[model samples]
Target: MSKRLANTLGIILALLWIFPVYWMVNTAFLPASQSRSTTPTFVPFGGDFSAFSRVLTPSFMNSLFLSLRVTLLVVVVALIFAFLAALAVSRFRFAGRKGFILTILIVQMIPAEALFISQYKMLQGWGLLNSVAGLSLLYVAAVLPFTVWMLRGFVDGIPADLEQAAMIDGCSRTSAFFRITFPLLAPGLVASGVYAFLQAWNEFTLATVIMNPSTKTLPLWLRGLAIQSNQATDWPGVMAGSVLVALPVIIFFMLVQGRMTSGLVSGAVKG
Candidate 1:
């Protein structure tokens, strides 16, 4: 295709992808009747803030905090474990190392649904049901395998010679790593973090089985809002709730948007 044609196609695809998000924001502010109307209001020129006002209940705050806890826990715990495991497998030679890598792949292949019953029992045995810690554990496990696999690629891309060269100049092994190798891994860490955040934040099915009504995540809370609407589903309210749910992810991607694409090997030495 010609350059002009390619640019035209790209713009078309971009607009297509963004239309749903545009509709969502448009619906979020529309009055109830307008939102449910047969004729669509594309711009929602006379949008109402009532749906947004109704969305900020005490329960919404509770679920927001609960979700924040789970996401924070998953990101921190998964990164720490995954970084270490990836470093080990990438830099060291050990018995069962191949098996360990194989296990991560195998775990990823197993459908999460298959583990729900057993996971629930395991959490129940540990008295973790209805607790943020319990739910966070599951999220960590769910994201950890992929996190490790991804970080391993980053680790492999970074040459061990960088650390060794620093050590040759009188720095201790640990010191060289902290000064040289570690700094280059920033992009990878941020990338891994984004994936983990998105997974834990938007997760619904696992939350449905693992968390009861007493413990609510943003996804669960949004569902309850719809269910509570009863005879007349509050389209505006549901749209508002969806926008609320998506804000964090959007804000986060904006903040780290540059670093994510800077590439894992960008800063690393070729050797």
Candidate 2:
């Protein structure tokens, strides 16, 4: 294809992806009557913040905070565990190491839906249901295997020579790794962290099964909003809720997107 044509196609694809988000924002600002009117208003000229105000009431804010707590916990725990496990498998050749790597793959192969019953029961037995810790722990387990494997690839791609060079210059093994290889792994870490964050933030089925009404997360709260609306569905409120839920993800991407593309592998020798 011609360069111009390819560029056009890419722009078109990008617009297609962004249209839904635009629609959500459009609806969020629209008046309730305009939303349900026979003639749909594509643009919001005099946007009202009433729906947004209602969605931000204390109950909804509580769910938002709860979701944030779970997502943060998931990201931190999953990244730590993935990092150490990736380092071990990539740096060492201990017995059962190969099997351990394979097991990560196998564990990911098992569909999450299939394990919901057992997962719920296990948490219930441990008295973890409807709790932030319980939900975060489950999120970690859900995202860990794939994240570890992904980080392992990035780690394996980093030549050991850099760390060795640092060690020869009198740096301790830990310092050598921290000063040398860790910088190179930053992109992979950000990518993996984004994945874990999105999973924990957006996952509904597992959260629905585990969390109670009182401890609802954002997605769960959104679902409840949908059901509660009944005949007079609060499209504006729902869209407002969506925007609120999406803000963190968008801000996060903007923050890390630069690092994901630059500096992460800036000084690293790839093997």
Candidate 3:
């Protein structure tokens, strides 16, 4: 009985959590007339693709490409650097190991907002503002410290004995580490990549400060929906734009979710 009640409660909570997303989709399809009406249209029964058509512009395409470029770069760069650093700190004992770990923790504690001015100045000095390279650099910087720490835990969680055992089986040290351990790090890497993806793709503050209209990301283009010069706010168009902005992230999660589930299960069984 308790289990049934808990399941019911879980379903209810899930539905509640998903309601906003449902409404966003609903509104995106809703006609501007119906969307702006006092009565809510729960399901866009008489809706059309007008909202989507209106929202799709050259700027939208540019933003989409720009955001993709930045996000992909950050994810790849951050995962590579973090994985290496995590492995080094976890497996090899070198000088300043403790200090390196402490520095990572300390960097996380510092507020991101505090560094905005300096980051801007530094980017400005390097003539990288309003560029994909500049944006990706900052996103990687923001993501690496946490990613390294997270991956360090993952590396530590896998027992070193496994690698040693592989080494005893006529496997070289490099071969043993890769064949025995690297596969297990998939879940952690995907999770860290997801974090970096979200940070780089949806970040508006840095986008606003660093990019102009020519290099606007999806988030910044979405921001432009809020106000139209001498025109009334197009609520339906805004909602449609929001949906488009969210699609890449939703699609990315869906694509990686399978890997994440399988990796975790595989790692657990192997461990």
Candidate 4:
């Protein structure tokens, strides 16, 4: 295809992907009566923010806060542990090194749902149920293997010679790594952060298993909203809640995208 044609096609595809999100935002501003109508309304012409109001109520806010806390905790803990693990695996060889990487792969292969029973039992045993720390610990475990694998790739992608060059110039090994090679891993960190954010944010099964009445996450709260039949399925409110849930992810991506793009470019040019 010609460059112009490819650009047009890309734009078209982008619009196709964005349509559903746009529709959700549109619906959230609508009243329930308008949203539930068989004939769909493209715009909330008679727009109202009542759905948003309900979506941000104290109960929903609690869920939001819980999910955000868990997501942030998972990202920070996962990144620190995964970054170190990635550096070790990439920079040094030791007994069981291969086995360790293989174990990460094996862990990823296992279904998350399969671990729910054991996870619940472990949390219950530790008296961690219905707690943010409990839920975040589970999320970190769930996300760690993949994040490790991801950061390993990034670590490996940076040539050991770069750090060696810095070391030859009288830099300590740690300083060489921190000053020379670390900057190159920004994209990797951002990518892993995005993955951690999405996984923790959207995860429901583990949350549902570990968190009870007082510790509900956003997904759990949304599920509760979804299951209620007598309330006539407040589609507007649900959509609003979803949008609110999505806001953090959007903001996070925007904040990291610049660094990610720059890192990609730097890596490409260096390669």
Candidate 5:
């Protein structure tokens, strides 16, 4: 395709993808009546914040806190373990290494639904259901394999000669790795961390099965807004809650975006 045509097509595709997000924000400002109007309003000239205000209830706050706690735990735990596993697989040749790699692939291939019953039973047996720690464990398992695979590529892309060079200059192997290699892996770590955060933050199916009503996460709480009354759905409140739910992810990306870019470029040049 011609360069001009490709650029135009790309912009069009981008707009198409962003339109739903725009509509969501737009609807969040509208009143209940306007939000459900047969004719869509392109803008909210005098939009009210009542919907947003209503979403700030104690229950919502509690659920938001729970979601944050679980997500943070998942990211920290998953990244630590995945980083180590990736380093080992990429740096060392050992017995069953291939098998271990194959196992990660096989686990990824298996559908999550297939293991729901077993997962639930295991957690129940361990007396960990409806707790942040329990939910974090499941999130770690779900996110770990992909993260290991991703970090493995990063580790493999990094040349071992740099670490060896540092070691030859009187640094210990551990010191050489930390000083010379770990810095290069920052971008990979950040990217993997973002993945873990999103997975843990937005995971609904597993949370639904694992958590009780008293320990509901943000997604579950959002679901509650929809079914608050049997009479009708609260579209406006739901939209507002959605906007709230998405804010952390957007803000997080914004906060780390510069670091992510720097890491990517540095890793590329170093590798």
Candidate 6:
């Protein structure tokens, strides 16, 4: 009875969580006239596509490209650095190792808002403001520490014996690590990459401060849509833009979902 009750509660919570998403999608298909109606239109049968049409402007396209570039760069670069750092910490002992780990923790502890002034100045000094590279650098810094910490746990969880056995079987240390342990870390890598992707994609405050008007990301562009006119906000257009913005993330997960699921199950068994 308790188990059934728990399952019922879980389903309720899941529905509650997904309600906003369903509403956004429903609103996107709604006509402007019906979008703001006091009674909600839960279904969008025979709804107009004008909102989506309006959302596909050149400015929106540019923002979409910029966001994609920055997000991909952040995910790739953060994953590489975090992988190396995690490997070093988990597999080898070196001077100041504890201090290095402590520093990662400390960096994560610092509020991102507090560093805005300094980060802005640094990027400005480097003349990277309003550039994809500049935004990517900041995104990497923001996500790297957490990625490293998460990957390190995965690294530590893998038995050293596996790598040693491969080495004993005529494999070089580097070869053994890549051929054996690296494959095992796939789940961790995917999980961390997802986190970094979401962070870089949805991040607003830093992007607003760093990017110029011409180089706004998708989130900034969405904000612009909300306040584009002095007249009433275009709720339908905003919802449409939101749906478009989220499509890439959904597609990304779809592509990697199988690998991620297998990795999770493998990691659980290993753990």
Tens digit of lDDT per residue, candidate 5, span 76-162? Answer: 999999999999999999999999988887777666678889989999999998988888988898888888887988899899999
lDDT of 4: 0.84
User: Could you tell me how far off, in angstroms, the CA of residue 210 lies in candidate 3 after the best superposition?
Assistant: 1.1
Look at candidate 3 and tell me the lDDT of residue 66.
Answer: 87
Q: What is model 4's C-alpha RMSD?
A: 5.2
Model 1 lDDT per residue over 138-249, tens place: 8888888878887888899999999999999999999999999899998889888987898899998789988989779999999998898577888788889999999988
The worst-scoring run of ten residues by lDDT in candidate 2 lies at 262-271
What's the C-alpha lDDT at position 10 in model 3? 97
Q: What does the lDDT come to for candidate 3?
A: 0.83
Task: Report the lDDT tens digits of candidate 2 across residue range 183-207.
Answer: 9999889888987897899889889
Candidate 4 lDDT over 1-271, as tens digits, reads 8999999999999999999999989999998889878899997799899999977788998888888799889999999999999989998999999999888877776776778898889989999988998889988887888778778888999999988989999999989988989899998898888878878998877888888866689988988877879558898998998888888778877776765465444331110
Query: Please, what is the whole-model Cα lDDT of each candidate in the order they appear?
Result: 0.86, 0.85, 0.83, 0.84, 0.86, 0.86
Shift of residue 74 alpha carbon in model 3, Å: 0.2
Residue by residue across 40-148, what tens digits does model 3's lDDT show? 9898898898999999988889888888899999999999999999999998999999999888877766666778888899999999988899988887887788778
Candidate order, TM-score descending: 1, 2, 5, 6, 3, 4
- Please give the ranking of all candidate structures by lDDT, highest first, separated by commas: 1, 6, 5, 2, 4, 3
Where's the lowest-lDDT run of ten residues in candidate 3? 262-271
Runs in model 3 deviating more than 4 A are: 1-19, 229-231, 251-271
Superposed model 5: Cα runs more than 4 Å off:
1-16, 36-39, 251-271
- State the lDDT at 50 in candidate 4: 95
Residue pair clashes in candidate 3 = none
Clashes of 1: 0
TM-score result, candidate 1: 0.87
